[model samples]
Each structure stands twice: as C-alpha cells, then as structure tokens.
Target: MLIPITREKFEQLIPLIATGPQYAYFWGKLPMVLKRLLISVVALVVIFLLGLAFGEGFYFFRLLFSIIAGLYWFWGPIYWASRRNLEIRRYKYSGFWRGRVLDVFVTDEIVGTEETVSNRGELVIVENRERRLNVEVGDETGFTTIMQGPLRRTHKGIAEGQVVEMLILSNQPDLGRIAKTSDIYIPRLNIWVSDYPYLQRVIFAQVSSQLSEAEERDYPDNRAVINRRRRR
Candidate 1:
C-alpha cells in the first residue's frame, strides 16, 4: 500500500541540511533568509565596483572586475540554485505519496560489509564482520529494489524483514502504474533509498542504534590461537 505524504510530515522527516559539506556548513549554521541576504549583499557590491570602474573609463580594470564578478554572480549562484531547486522539486513530487510494504526479497548481489578486528601481541582477535544485504520491496503497484546495503552499516547480523510505510511518485497513476525505485527519495535521510520507505527507515534507524553483533555466525577457538613458540 502507498499513501500520500503531507508537507508537515515531510519537513519533519527530512534532514536539517541536505547538500555537500560547503553548502551544508551554511545550511546548518545560517537560516535561509540570512543566506539570501549575504549573497545579495556580495553581488550588489561586485556590481557597484564594476560600475565605478566602467564610469572612470578604466577599460582594463572594468573588464577584469566584470569577469570576476560575472563568475561569482553567474556560476556560483547557478550551481547552488540548481541543486536546491532540484531537491525542492523532487520533494514536492514525492510529498503527496504514501504506501505500504507488501513483500521483501534479498538480491544476490552483495554491495559491501563492515568488520572490526582487535589484535594483541601474539593473538589476533577478530570481532564482527557484517554483510550488506541487497533487497527488493514489493508494493501494491509494483516492486522497488535498493542497490546498496539493505541493513544499516551499524547493524551487522539483524535479518529483519521489510514491513513499513513509504512514499512513491506516480508517473502515470491515472493508468494505475508507479515509478521505478531509482526515481524515489527517502525524505528521512534526504537521499534516494528506493521507492520503499519502510526499508529505508529500517536501515537508517539501524545506523543510529547501538546494536553490535558478529557478522559470522560461528567463531572457532582455533581461529584465535596464538603463534607462541620458544626460540630453538
């Protein structure tokens, strides 16, 4: 089952900041109004200086200033604006969608795994090595699969099934069809986690939890045997 998402819920679930480190720094620290004001002020100053140079008949100086100002005003904002606009548009499309998980399937492909090893002078202690699961989630409309590790990187041995709610974008819902998993984004993590919300939530929550278990089921005593021999 898939349901529609509301603006309020989507705002609460998405991350506070959704961008690269440089932009994230601004997003995390400053409000949107302040960001806009700062950029506007800088742009005006650049324009003012360029105007002054041109008025003074300093063609060489005006040209140099114009080039620098043009790059900053044109390219910088365009880059940031494009990224922000795309994210906003994506959320708008997905915000109205909600659905339930009907089935879960494990894919044969293994994305990656996480392991921890502790070593002593003579004995090498291997602790946990968690395998990543690739999963496919089926809904009332269609199936959406995740290409990355199904479980959170932090949760190693927990083989939990997908049984949660999610949001989906309907490309042609009038015809009773749904979009692909790749076209969906999990607002909770502010990233694409397939079109399945339940699976995304499980993996994301696992990453935040303190559950640690060995990836391998059995650990033989011989595996930890120390290499101790007297010099002969």
Candidate 2:
C-alpha cells in the first residue's frame, strides 16, 4: 500500500540525530522534539561544567571554552538539517508505503574494506568478498523497485513471499510512481535493511498500525493478494 505524503510532513519525520534500531534500523526511535531537548540539556550541562572548570582568572581558557560551547551548540543541528535535506533533496516527492518481496537474487561480489591485520604485520587494506541480496519488491500500485542496502547485505535466508515494508520516493508525485526506496523493514524477520536512515521509525510504526487497522476494516477475499508491477 502506498500513501501520499507532503514534503513538509516528510521532513518532520526525519531525525536530527541518529536513533538506534527500531522500525527503521538506521533511524532512531524517538520523537524529534524530545531528542532535541535531550541533546540540548546534555550539551548545555557538559559545556557548563567545562566552562566552570576552565576557571575565572584565565581569559584564554574562557575564550576557548566559549568557542567550544558555541561550536557544540551550533554544529549538530545545522549538520543534521543539511544531511536530512541531502537525503530528500533529489526526491521531488515520496510516499509512506508497505509491500512484499517478490523475488531474491543473491550473488557473491568483491568488496573492499580497510581491515587491521593482527599479526607480525600492521594494518592492511583488503578486499572483502560478500554475497549481495537483491530484493525485488512491489505492491498493487503496478510499480516495482529494487532496494539495495549494506544493509543486511549478506544472504540471510530471505526468501520470496515475505512482507517488506518501507518508504518509497519519486522525482515526480503527479505521476504517482516510485523511483527510489529506503528504511526497509521485514516484519516477520524483524529486520531493517537500508543504505541510509530515512523515515522517523516511531511514526512509521504508527502508520503501519493504522494501515493494518484499515486493511482489517476493509474486508476482502480470503485468498492471498499477489503483488504485480505492470511493466512500463
């Protein structure tokens, strides 16, 4: 199911700081205002203690502390806003959606990473080979897209017919099409796969509940609904 969303609403769902696992793994599971308040209180208290510790007689120390405090107060919010914008900047519009995995194509590929070697030698960069699971998912909307993530990247027995839920985006909303995806959560497996954090996880879960309730309310056939994406 795909539910249309406004840009403003979408931005409001994004987080200012990383929230540890939940509806979306990369995103946090806290309210935006609450997270901001917590960050502010902590940042202020830590800065205040440091400021006092710098002492009253040292002008140099005072100046340094002031700079540090100002930077602390200023950096995070600004940086987060810019990052969130970058996440959605390419997207002209997006949708809150839930769907199922149609197919899985797993293949091993060469991947490189900087790994420290614990031997008579030192740190060495090595090429890491890993399997990639390409999850092809779709809804009744007649649109299908592949969501790639690092990302539970390995093959973990994810098979066809499992429910895959996430947010989908499009460069154009009037067209009512899906071009990109993020924050994929498999409810049955209780796993979140994504290249980057996207939706506010808490809100996502609430929306999921609402969607489920609506589905139950609208009684349909007892038979299963197979997702088919009309080929363009």
Name the top TM-score candidate. Answer: 2
lDDT of 2 by residue, 141-220 (tens): 76787866652533485777677778777887663666767767776665666655676666777666676666656745
TM-score of 2: 0.57
Q: Write the per-residue lDDT of candidate 1 for residues 20-113, one digit (tens) a residue.
A: 4324323432344455556656865776776776686766665675566545533454455345434543534332232322333444443334
TM-score of each: 0.34, 0.57
Alpha-carbon error at 135 in model 2, in Å? 1.6
Off by over 4 Å in 2: 20-85, 109-125, 151-157, 219-232
In TM-score terms, candidate 1 sits at: 0.34
Model 1 stretches with alpha carbons more than 4 Å out: 6-133, 140-142, 147-152, 155-160, 173-175, 180-232
Best by lDDT: 2
The local distance difference test score of each candidate is 0.39, 0.63
- The per-residue C-alpha lDDT of model 1 at residue 113 equals 40
